[model samples]
Target: MKRNFLLLLIFVLVVIAISEGIGFQSIPIGKFNIGLLPLVFAIIITMVLGIRIFRKGIIKKIYSKENVNFASKYLIFIMLPLMARYGADVAPKLKEILSIGWVFLIQEVGNLGTVVLGLPIALLIGLRREAIGATLGIGREGELAYISEKYTLESPEGRGVLSLYIIGTLFGAIFFSIFAPVLLDLGFRVEALAMASGVGSGSMMTAASSTLVARMPELGETIRAYASASQLLTSFLGTFTMVFLAAPLQKFMYGLFIRGEK
Candidate 1:
């Protein structure tokens, strides 16, 4: 166990070192600037290295299923407390969110637009139940929990949500990082973007806020605070939307459009 932790720590340090070395590189696209961070680069490096090592069959036991599982569990154990602390940090900021007035409410509603947009697209693409499930869900752990509980893990809906969850987990952050800055260049306010970033996923929020902060460092704390507050709002209300609104809306759309049912 100690050896595994030591290895993990070493890997973390290496990634951080590599990230810091190359973190300052930024790309200018027209009037918009895109920034990169060591954290993002570190993640990419770790993935590449892990794949190479795996393919080479080097240190196979270190990458064994049991070890991987243990590491995953350990990460969750560490993460949960941190997440709780983050929630607490954001709690005082709830009044700030409310102070934003109707904009905050509208943004919160817009956060669930995925379900609104996704269901029709899924039906148009000729997706059935499971695919619809995946498409309508926002591809997060909370959505996964709801889908799994309501539909069971082995159901088509479960499979759909799970597929989305995996895809979102892997790519959502990168997508946010790349696009948020571009959107800002396109004339969106940082506060609006920050609220948008909160769409019920911590990673996505982090990526989006990071991009904004990188581009506009002066507003870093404010951007993060708004984003975090928006995320907390989403976390609390997203479940209700999914259970009461999104689910039914998806079913109604699917049945009406695809199944041609009255």
Candidate 2:
């Protein structure tokens, strides 16, 4: 129990720091680029605390049924908006909110939203259920590819899910492209604004903006920074969002697709 509380605190602190526009360079870990020193410190704190808690058998306690239920409710309230914001960003209204400095809070929540919202969306769009098996990067790419191939369903169902992913990605791309100008107009350093918003969108917006930056080298660092931060935020936020929404989404599934059958 203590471990979970401490870990959550550390994560919240990191979120606060990222929101406040603080970051630093660090050693890379394979495919992942490490963030600022404070991030490193926070990670270390989490690791140390987690190890300590493990020795005390607190994890089991934290995962007890009652605690899990409480955590689930909290996750629903916090994570739903996060993902909703992420999926709906292809417009000006969201950008306007960022310009006023709501980016930090929204971005913080967004890191948790993708999974909360992404998985349910994936299920509804009919991605063969196997694609989501790879959602957490828990298994190998070959496994997901194999599952998708073996469970190939009707062409129409495949197309439908693909269409949903397409729409989601399009919204992410358009939101960043349109918002870039707004940030520039607001006198925010292009890279900073990009970094902030990209994190919120799970780096899906990075390619769109990076292409734009490629045409203008002056924006390279900003684009790189945005991509880096966004990717990290996405991994962490997306996973937590999934954990948070799992229960609620399960209930939703019966209502939307399995009504009266079960």
Candidate 3:
């Protein structure tokens, strides 16, 4: 455990060093600037290292499978409380969401847009059970839990969702950082974008909100408040949608459009 903690600390410091080192280089899209290449590069490097370790059997020699599994499980124990704190931070500012009126409320409903958008695309692409799970699931812990409970992680569905969750965790922030600024340049209101950023993932919300706040410093607090409220709504309601609506809806869509039901 001490070794694992030391490794984790070293890993974080390396990532931070890389992020700062590469902070100056950025990709510019029109008037908007998309930085954070260092962060992205760090993530890719970590992924490549992990893949090499696992595929080359280096991981087994260096670390016991049980210890690795223990780290993976307990890491979530650390993350979940931080996430809940993010949700808790929204409590005082939640009424601000109401001030934005029904448009914010309506956008909250569109939090399920993943299932709506992804299922069709997955079907069109002729994805099967496991791929369907990745497509329909929002790629969060709640969705992961539901899928794991119903279908073990070794199942195709579980693998699908887990893969999506991994991808989402690694790149979702960078994508949102770029995408949010582009949307703003396209003339979307900050309120709408703030609410949109709250799609239940704290990493995503942080990325989007931070980018927007950097761009428009005057609206930083408002943007954060709206984002927090929207995120809270997503986290709260996303649970119900994943368990009751998303899974069933995906199955129904597959049965209706595709040939097999598994």
Tens-place lDDT digits, model 2, residues 1-262? 5667665455566655753454333334554332333323333343454454563455445445555566635754665564454444323333443464444434555443433555566657765443333232222222223234644434433343344444443354444444454455556666555655454333245533553354346755545545444544545554454445532453455346545642
TM-score-based ranking, best first? 1, 3, 2
lDDT score at residue 71, model 3, on the 0-100 scale: 60
**Each candidate's lDDT (Cα)?**
0.73, 0.45, 0.73
Question: Which residue pairs clash in candidate 2?
Answer: 24-36, 83-113, 111-237, 116-241, 191-222
Q: TM-scores of the models, in the given order?
A: 0.86, 0.33, 0.81
**Residues 129-192 of candidate 3: C-alpha lDDT, one tens digit per residue:** 7766686656887878877888889998888889999889878877888888888888999878
Q: For candidate 2, which ten residues in a row score worst on lDDT?
A: 134-143
For model 1, the superposed segments whose C-alpha errors exceed 4 Å read 1-5, 50-54, 59-62, 80-96, 260-262
TM-score comparison, 1 vs 3, better candidate: 1
Q: List RMSD in Å for every model shown.
A: 2.8, 14.7, 3.6
Ranking by lDDT: 1, 3, 2
Q: What is the alpha-carbon RMSD of candidate 1 to the true structure?
A: 2.8
Task: Give the alpha carbon lDDT tens digit for every residue of 1-262 in model 1.
Answer: 7676566567677678878888755789788777665656766665666574463443444555666777766766755764575576566666776777577666656645776788777767766777655866677877788777878879888888888886786677777888888899999999889888888877777778888988889987778778877777788877787778777877777777765543
